[model samples]
Target: MFKAKNVIRIGKGANAVLARPLSGIPLAIWAFSLTFALALGSTAAQQTPPPNPHSPPPTSVTHQMYLDMKLGTLNIHGDNAVVEALVLQRDIPITYDYVATLMRTPNAFGEGPACIVCHSSNDQLKSYRGLNLSSCEGILLGATEAPANPIVIKGEPFQSHLIQRIRNNRMPLGTPFFAPVDTDSILAVKDWINAGALNDENFTTKVLPLFVDPVAFGSETACTECHKSFRDPPSFNEVNLTSYDAIMTGAFSKTRKKQNLPGLPIVVPSNAEASPLYQRLTTSRMPPGTDPGSPADHPNTLLLMRWIEQGASCD
Candidate 1:
């Protein structure tokens, strides 16, 4: 602090200053100095650069405003004026169901994309990271590893881990680098988060799939015998293959010890090798002690394989 004549010059770092005085200083001089300092500060603040509204104010969250110009209904001078004058284009609000669509659909973001291929309720990878990106609720609930932070922050898009992971290509592991989630999809996630991630009021919730429908699966291999009951060494108790919808839902493997491959799908459409349902039926792996068995040549097994290869339409 430096005192000169009647005004005390208070140093406010390199770019600003505070002007005050003691009782001994002349009140008139002090007042004049204070006015001049305020004027100087106003000019300096204006010339500083574009104001970041998000930044906290020096004294409090409240900010000082002084507008000198106006045109029509718009302010043409001052920080708020500048911001109000410029047209800020906003995107349409995104819904919770929309995010789920991105997760379930293949190549929805673009080339060679598949999120549900690995992050479903039954997917082995879901347990590893504890994130089931299969549904909106799952995203909001977050993963076991990040229990403290929700995957999607309601109004802060960038703050959401879900968006950050997609933006940084940390999701859909094993996907080709050239065909990561597209920009539009990434932006959609951000927009959805910013829009409050509302769910569809009319959303008809269905049980997540465990396997392709055995009835619709075009198979007659008596799947319910082993799947419905644990009479054999391996029991498919996690899922019921008897019902059409139940079959389409997930069936986590009891034998797969790896927790890292969470939400692994059993009936990924259009890809035979990707679908465990198609694999188990086609091979002698199930109905134990049937290596090169009679079931391998069974027409029902062939029908099931064809159904999966044809994109396993649950409809």
Candidate 2:
């Protein structure tokens, strides 16, 4: 440790300041150095971090904030301030507190008990299908150890058995905790799982805006330019790329209907290769002519594909 006194040569007058020495150093010099050191320490301790506009507010609720930032009320998912608050942070956080809340909150409309009540496991009680919603680990580990049909498919929410049950009106046992498990709630879970079923709330805050933000996107063609609604009439295929919710909520495909199958989701959370949006950029190039546009590994197409791999957060 470099002490100020060691580096500082006392002036010739030092002997006059305090003739008596404490240990070896003069008492007056020691006192002055101690005072200065305390002052510096105090200043450093009191220093506030440079304002981080992207950090979540102390009073903000993660679940509510997630919903608020992605309500789909406007074409832009959230205000710039709110979006920045969720992004631009040192390290994106991971938490499933909101999902836990979803499982525990009593159903206002349904006569049945909360999801947790029936899905939890304990010495005295065990839910059917061995599903346990009481903890994050249990949910991710899923119902059966290795069922023929898996419960949660990590990056594929639609394929997850849990979502399938809710969508099919088979969950919560009785009247159902959320009537039909409100679209918003189901979407929340979908976002949760589609994000590789992790707790990173940044999964929604940091990614997905690339679709509309051409500057950040680093390309002449913005995906939202053609995909987002608000055109003269409306976007082709009714696929609104305006926000996270819109992109995740894909448009119907006649091809799938012809085969009596469901259409593939445009952006499948953490799976870009499986996403049709990426597929178009690679095969059957999207922007039509231009001698067939950018290649599959083109920077622009790779950008979109990469976004999905990062959980495709909308705001």
Candidate 3:
């Protein structure tokens, strides 16, 4: 460990500012960071090169390895076609819909019954983390619902918390100890996020139905269970998720400032990970009495992201 040292100024006047290192930086750590910064001229991700379709998926197919492999070799000229081809190369097409299928499949990884056998059950709140993997919308909301830390950070898979948890063996959490999922599945998902985590179909087809489905939130009641004023609710806190019109015109009233509760946005078009409403369902905060959701949970946070990514459109 590099011990903290007071930085010394070597030059007089304004040149001292240019010559000296910042005070709190540890020399070794600073040097290491600068070595890469100087070599790359920017964080490696500043160049969002699509994966080379012909290149094999890394034997260790996490985002970090992907970056290092590409950057070390200076192969940074990939394009949309390459991204499409690379992520689509697996036995399966990686998209929100496929993830939902895996969520519902019986004994998906030989660890236990399908994830939804438990996560989607009404009783999930009693034993599990309260994430409802029942639909694309719920999945996009993510498990933790932590706003600042999104489950899927599009175009930057390594930064996504979902990838972090899976690589660390912390998800698919259930009986049989949430063993590592298949390597192919993990790689496919990572590449999908790195490629902007697009939806297989339109938002209306994949996500809008979820807004009206009661069971999607692990509750018999739908989002309409609360906030009935789709057009004009009485309070600033309540938002209308009842219709496409209401949802698009999120918080129709500017009277939100006067309300006692904090007026957070329900949906942010093309950015579901940042939307508090999506975060609410993913963290299992809705339907009453579950962990307060944040946009941070991984397993429960991609479908809605795709919806938002697709412009949060109705049609």
TM per model? Answer: 0.25, 0.29, 0.26
| lDDT accuracy of residue 77 in candidate 3 | 26
* Model 2 Cα lDDT, one tens digit per residue, 225-274: 66676232346555666665566557654445568865447666666544
Which lDDT values do the candidates have, in the order given?
Answer: 0.38, 0.42, 0.41
Candidate scoring better on TM-score of 1 and 2? 2
* lDDT at position 116, candidate 1: 60
lDDT of 1 at 302: 25
Tens digits of per-residue lDDT for model 3, 1-315: 122344332223422211122222244544443333234323443556666779766674334434563464322221121222222222122455545655665523222356566556323344244556676655445554323233555555534444443332222111123223334333333343344434544344545565466655444545565554633444223566565555544553445546754344455655544444444443322222222222233222333334334433233
Clashes of each: 19, 3, 16
Sort order, TM-score high to low = 2, 3, 1
lDDT of 3: 0.41
Question: Candidate 3: where is the Cα deviation over 4 Å?
Answer: 1-201, 230-236, 252-254, 257-264, 284-315
Our model 2 lands, by Cα RMSD against the true structure, at 23.9
